[model samples]
Target chain A: MRFKWSNVVLFFGYLFLYFPLICIVIYSFNESRFVSTWTGFSFKWYKALISDPIILRATVTSLKVAGVSATASVILGTMAAIIIARWGAFPGNTLFLGAITAPLVMPEVVMGLSLLMLFVGMESFFGWPSRSGNITVIIAHITLTLSYVTLLVQARLQDLDNSIEEAALDLGASPLKVFFVITLPMIAPAIVLGWLLAFVLSLDDVVIASFVAGPGSTTLPMIVFSSLRFGISPEINALATILMTILSIAVIMSAVFIYKDGNIKNM
Target chain B: MYRIEEIIISWFSELMKKIKGRHFLVAIPYGWVFVFFICPCLILIRISLAENLIASPPYTSLIEWISGYMLQIRINLGNYMVLFTDEMYIRGFATSILIAGTSTICCLLMGFPMAYAIARSSEKIRGILLMLVVLPFWTSFLIRVYAWIMLLSPCGFINNLLIRLNLIEAPLQLMNNSCAACIGIIYAYLPFMIFPLYSAIEKIDYTLMEAAYDLGSSPLKAFFSIVVPLAIPGIYAGSALVFVPAIGEFVIPELLGGAQTLTIGRLVWNEFFGNMSWPTAASLSIILLIFVVFPIVFAQRRREAKLSIVD
Candidate 1:
């Protein structure tokens, strides 16, 4: 009975987790415009999604912003992580830690408004980032994802053995060379993880993107968000299906990679 | 692969050398975070003190230089006063807290057992189970929330399924209610709750549980005494993780919540975007921030104090 209870709990939990996702995928092929009610399956929504220019544009824009911001965030986050994990006490170290991690717990709405205010304030003062658009959106995303990336890398860094780097340093390698040859390779997994996390976060963000996006730079999430308020659409179902498939592929690939890495380490 | 690795290493080394000093690398991110993260929050504080206006930037400046270096500053407390006096803001604040609190409890209930099961699972299955929990979180949050709308709408999956089963004579109105809103929040945040609890429960020495069992303690009693107390930190962390974001949740409540449901995030959104009342929005945000941030800052201080003692 105890074993049965454990199985029941896990079954219900996984059911709750994946049922809605399966519904979305199934309904994307749904012939009916309405999400519910199973008609004969058809590929009409996916076809419609292919030709929808706004969604296509938003998808492209989301990809661009996510890519740029994720790259930037990884670089910045890695630096912050390195400092926190490796560097000893420095001036304003506590302050730096506080600033880097504040966004993690800070509410999205608060962060959005603050960044929006900053953009507006800066634009008025310096005339750079004159309009809230791609650059502004990227900056906001980098700020939001930086904390997450930093946390991931910092955790990895804390677990890292320092003897490897110390040995390289003793061999007369410059600090720069040592970091690149030794430490960077050691933390590459964390960096990659951080980048992927930052990418997903930026791609998924709606509130902050809504706050900072200009007329022409609307992201896919923003589009999905607005469409949701009005009513359901099959096109969105199709889009969701595509996104889920992509994410599943990514997840599976990474799982395979991790498994292989484990096997290699075991050998 | 070896050639590609060489290229990457050379690029990285050259990039590192381009920065004159090792400290400069640290300075880059440090400066970026200070300017972007810290400065914007500081700007929020300043902007919250300003008067709302109809002009381009939409708020009166808080600072002015008086004759010959005497700085004249005007701070508007009226914005905050409005938030207090206005029934809408007050109701919104209360409603948000109520909804978030309820949703956090819901997530905790659902996530705790699942986490426990995963922690108790075989090592191989545990990793796969953990991955399954985290997979949905990687997908678009907006899309996940939208999934609930499809499931909860009048013509949604659950209602249709029930109707087909003859469990109900007609489709129940499941969508656009506080119930749906809570469901959406619990679904979305369950992973956050589960992962922390899993880590916490995984750390428990199973030998203790075995000893309890040997002493003839009831399984429930053993669980309550041995597991629950040990998982307090996870509970607190999970609750904070869910509660803080759920309190200011915009998209979930906006999409899933009924017309009457007014969360602080939705209110802030409307004030900033709908009413164009920047100061009022800022003030409401400030109030919300204070409520949300106080617990977090307090907890951090406690943790720091504990850590200092340990050191």
Candidate 2:
């Protein structure tokens, strides 16, 4: 292939994107506590990170919130996607679309503030969900991540062939049965992708979690944000390295799976 | 027991039959969004008009019952007035727009070529390239911003290398500045800009470019005249994606912009968390929402108009 100017820009662009991440990964193993100086390789920081109780508890909370929020977002988003793509225009369709897409562009600070107010209002009125906790954080995350899931599934649904579902329905299958047996399987990949996206979004959230979470509940990002105020720490580097490693693996596996699925469909 | 169970099942089935499947599907998500998303925004607006209080909720109710058959309503415009009159709040909003706009332009410049290259590549490599762009996004956003801290700090990698090479007498003042914040924002949001641009560029008819080239147009001329014009939608989409979130980005500005930089996000965060003034924070949020939502609604209306015209 002939060399082009675009290739040079692309090369530098990718380097710019990956260089900082790679620096963190390499420095995580540095024996020196300071992030700049590299002495020798050691896993001592990793051990320290593992032993930190705050990090561990925060991680557990983050995982639980991410799992539940992602599942809920996927279900709700899929239903919304189906309605938008398959149900045709209906009353309040414009409002529905606006609400679905608003979160995608909404500022995190605004979203957090508004949701916190809602929870506080609910508490005063109903005297339930007495305070912000994991439940509140989960609800906030579900709202935040729902838009992403809906957009993904909606794109997939629009591209889908409707004749297969129609054929199933004509074959004396109930609409519910046709949805389960035919449509769901066809859109399963998109659903899975949406779930993973939501999970990552929830896990990565700090601003919203900080607003909605009470003093009793702290997620991993909140802990990291607090520690980061003291400047760079080797433990954060270790934690970042671990998170990056797991995320890289998950992303690569999903990419490969999607690519393979596409190839099979082409065949 | 059997008779009761049968009756209950039949009633439930009858109720299900009464609700059409499509309505049920629509109601589930619509109701969730209405309660969680819409209600919160409405409450935010209401609270923005309420007076600050020292009570647990921290904001006084807007409406009160003075007596039987009598009503009293209190609307505090002071919260919004503070946002407009206070130097800190005004500067915060100005700095946020300026920084977010600058970073968005940088993202466009940096992402365009990368997106174009990926779009022009072979199909096999295209998928991989797209995956590469999306991979970093899945990792921690805070960690990514923190990575810039490690890179741009005085004792960080770049400075260390420069000092070792005798390139400078002292480390440059790179960290804790607006420039660093811009760089961090650009790095973090470049992928967002590229995805929309790539999708748009990929759909362009290369034949049009070829046709322009055949008409004695220079390659650069052809690119500007043909490719750029066609990619306007993508540019708008990508710019919106980058600019909106960048304006309210608390982490990047807080970490990279240092104490000197006063973005709206940090202002709201401080007002809410530091001062514990819920009304002021709510007012800030409402203003920020107006800044964000109005442009989006305008764009959607324009697009709808365009579509209707085509139809």
**Model 2: residue B88 alpha-carbon error in angstroms:** 1.4
Q: Which stretches of candidate 1 lie over 4 Å from their true place?
A: A263-267, B1-20, B66-71, B167-170, B298-311
Q: Tell me the tens digit of each residue's lDDT in model 2 across B80-176.
A: 9988998999988899999999999999998888888898888877877887898888889999999988888887888888988999989998989
Where is the poorest 10-residue window by lDDT in model 1 chain B?
B298-307
DockQ, computed on Cα atoms, for candidate 2: 0.74
| RMSD per model, one decimal | 7.2, 4.0
Tell how far residue A14 is off in model 1, in angstroms: 0.6
* TM-scores for candidates 1 onward, in order: 0.93, 0.93
lDDT against the true structure, each candidate = 0.87, 0.88
Tens digits of per-residue lDDT, candidate 2, A1-267, equal: 324776787789889989999999999999998865679999999999999999999999999999999999999999999999998897889998998888988889999999988998898899866554688999999999999999988888888899988888888999899888888887888888889889999999999999899877799999999988777888999999999999889878876777777832321
DockQ for model 1 equals: 0.69
Q: Tell me model 2's lDDT, rounded to 2 decimals.
A: 0.88
| Best candidate according to lDDT | 2
The reply for model 2, stretches above 4 Å from the true place, is A263-267, B1-17, B20-23, B298-311
